[model samples]
Target: MGSTEEERPEGLLGWCLVANVARETLHGDSGLDLQHGTKHFSADALLWIPPIPWDPGHWRWPAVGRHRGNSRRYINMVVRAEDLENFRVKGVYSEALVRSLNGHRHDPAAPRTLQNPWSREQAQSWADRWNQPREPVRIDGRSHPLLSVPNPPPAELRVNGETLHLAHYGTRGAHYSRNPPPTEQP
Candidate 1:
């Protein structure tokens, strides 16, 4: 950000966690390490709080995933060491696991998955672009009311248990079509 100012934020720090969780990257026990619920890990001196993706109005599981009308529910969250919460167990946590996810703070829109690996960099930029106090994303022109939920990146990242599986991913022209065979992520 110091040198690349105009195209990005004024003080953009490139070292940010990227907050990435693509199914391909989270495959195996790796996904298990990054469970759906919030976690209090140290990405360095900065505390990391990976909040579970959820809803505000009815306090239900918010939809998430790549394709249209499809959604994946997360099950964990993390907070900074100084954050006001603690992990009491280690299993499939229920709704009660997250008492104050600030549901009053999340109105997430399942943004479309980034269509390219280069866009992975674009999606990473949102770490700084959307981190500030702002409104959540909008789908079909409607925004979630909470306005604090960190919307999913404009890319689909699926994780089975603790593993990221590239079931089938690629670009448009050469993508895996339902008719024949499933391909791979590029």
Candidate 2:
């Protein structure tokens, strides 16, 4: 018999749902967050979505600690090569975030953040501005460069009621096995 849909491999890029539902005794509410829904990833890199809190003053805990869980639930995907390329081409560029994706430790001075790539319309506007050069203008006692549109940096994809962030890679090590405790001989 041919392989089923579950037997296929995911492409080098694109989004996928990652759910982790490990036992509660070993973890806390943190495991529940990962159990909720979809996520995106490249071949070896995972997208780290920032957590939103109901109260801006209080820091959210679940999203930050999902990694402590030991179990996960996800479906395998079969993706085309071209689709992967599309993601890479349109993907946002962040030097710090990219470093983390490549499995490097985060730099203290450079907190990782996602900057979305320019959209077609936005890019066109930028081009138009550059094409027609003009003198700088003074704003709030500071000279602003001509054609500067201070739009927030681009970020890709907005999941309903959820925030997405870039993943940070840190020191990696192998899991070590411990020796069994001494037992009485029969």
Candidate 3:
């Protein structure tokens, strides 16, 4: 769906963690099945956990705990193609509900640098935090949950700093193209 009025989509639109979560610390005591299945989630992939924050926009990207508890590295949340419809319909959250998701994208406790505000060590641990594309995903009609979810095993994504598409990943750490991108000639 990376088309623009029948044209192609332009701009580096991917996803970002608009809010920070403290699920491990807050719900560590609770017996919640927080561990996303490995088959479902790749190392440094994304996710769309429940108890969502109220937003006019669907819950987009959330930093997945790569090191778990360490909060250093993370991936984005993935969702089913069917679920996107449910999120945009939800909006407005109470302050108490949103408090669980309060914090800086990076640790505000540390000093701010022009590039990576955190110190070198801090930055290294949370390196994936900086992997975000410069732009946010543009809502075209509606975004399918599968397209939005992290670790999209059933699908793959492509971003050319101007467009993104969903398709089979012919290669790992590859580039972006139209969904169902042309297969690599292995």
CA lDDT of each candidate? 0.27, 0.27, 0.30
In candidate 3, which residue ranges exceed 4 Å CA deviation? 1-60, 63-86, 105-186
Off by over 4 Å in 2: 1-115, 137-186
Candidate of highest lDDT: 3
Model 3 CA lDDT for position 146: 25
The residue pairs that clash in candidate 2, if any, are 48-165, 49-164, 49-165, 116-154, 116-155
lDDT of 1 by residue, 49-135 (tens): 233332333222221112212223332333222112221112112232122222344323412211111222443454455444332
Where is model 2 poorest over a 10-residue stretch in terms of lDDT? 168-177
Candidate 3: worst-modelled 10 consecutive residues by lDDT: 83-92
RMSD of 2: 25.3
TM-score of each: 0.17, 0.17, 0.18
lDDT of 3 by residue, 1-186 (tens): 634434322331211222223222111332233443333343333332323333324433332323334444344443322111111111213222122223233333422211112232443333343333221222232324223333333233343453455433321222333444577897
